[model samples]
Target: MLRAGQAREDIKVVSFDVDGTLVSPGFVDCVWLQGIPKAYAEKEGLSFEQAFEYVKSEYDKIGEHRIEWYNIDYWLRKFDLDIPYERLFKKYEDEIMIYEEVESVLAVLEEEGYELILSSNAANEFIEFQIEPIKRFFSHVFSATSDFGEVKKTNGFFARVCEILDVKPQAVVHTGDHWVFDFLNPRKIGITAYYLDRARKRNVTDEVRKEDDEFVISDLSELLDDPDC
Candidate 1:
């Protein structure tokens, strides 16, 4: 864990993932899942729980195709639910909350002259709601849907961020909770990476468990106390 006042001169920019990294209870998949499916089930004379189970089963049937069709609007249409996007957006808006320590840590990093950017897999509407409370801490926010048309793990996504930030991949540090999506992929592109193990999810793979250029911290507060941060 990194302690505060530990300044790394070489690191110029910091990129972060929204859901698990910045938020406390983490991002709710149910906002889109249970919400849309339950609405659809009601039209079909089924309970919300039954609808969720059926939709989840259907999702399993599709396997990896689930990722492609997992967006809010996609699920709504897939379940034959006719609710407008605005209503769906508003319903789950209050549920998106940041982790208790995130704001203060972000403030300290910003005070230290680190350029902060958001790199998230969430939809624009969802991302918009999530960042509303802490928008002042970031210089920019990039959505996987609107900015890259895919997740950060995709090829060329990190490259695009480097180009946009006008920095080499080696100069930036990306922090997130997911080992595969946050740490490993960016580290492959020559970026310094940090794994935020907030949920205490262990890395089962050798690549993630091994310490290379990657740093692991249980909380963002560690950054404020570490000399190497």
Candidate 2:
């Protein structure tokens, strides 16, 4: 527990994943999932169904864990899409929004003197645009492509963040929506991990129920009340 007026020495860094954690997934879903498919369909003169299938197939080939999966330029080249990637982002920029409870939680964290950082798998350009609404809360932002040259699924990526922050791995408490990248990988490297499954979408097996490291939670407000954090 933090003492009154303490500078958060127990948790030097409270790192957050940008997409689906602090912010809504609308922008990414529009650009990558919906916009890309729609554009592909129009470009190829195919139905939306066919284009979605093709895009899903291509994404499956690369998978979400790799660095290339998050690269817009790579996808543009692979699919021969002629539009500038920034234009796609601009189209959905207004849709980019933070969770209702995010700003309040961030305010509390900051008030308690914890260092707030954004550690995301999103591209730097994407992070830069989405964070304008809540940028003041963050001391620094780290992205997979621009900062790490590796995806968050790689343990090295989180390790590199700890290195860059000049803090011990365990000193950071990372909260995010991904079970692996946000919780598993960071926990493996000794960082405290909190799995933010707001939708409660994860299937809970008997084994999963018994795991000590996976601190599954449904909202950011829970963090403010959790004494252990």
Top model number, lDDT: 2
| Per-residue error (Å), model 2, residue 4 | 13
Model 1 worst lDDT window (10 residues): 1-10
- TM-scores of the candidates in the order shown: 0.84, 0.83
| Model 1 per-residue lDDT tens digits across residues 1-229 | 2232224577788889888788744346656575677787888989888887898887777654345554667667777778876786677767777888988888888988889998877667677777788988888887766667774454367778888889988778888887777877888888777888876666536554454423777787765555544
Tell me the lDDT of model 1 at 96.
73
Give the alpha-carbon lDDT of every model. Answer: 0.73, 0.83
List candidate 1 stretches off by more than 4 Å. Answer: 1-7, 25-27, 61-67, 203-214, 226-229
Residue 109 lDDT in model 1? 85
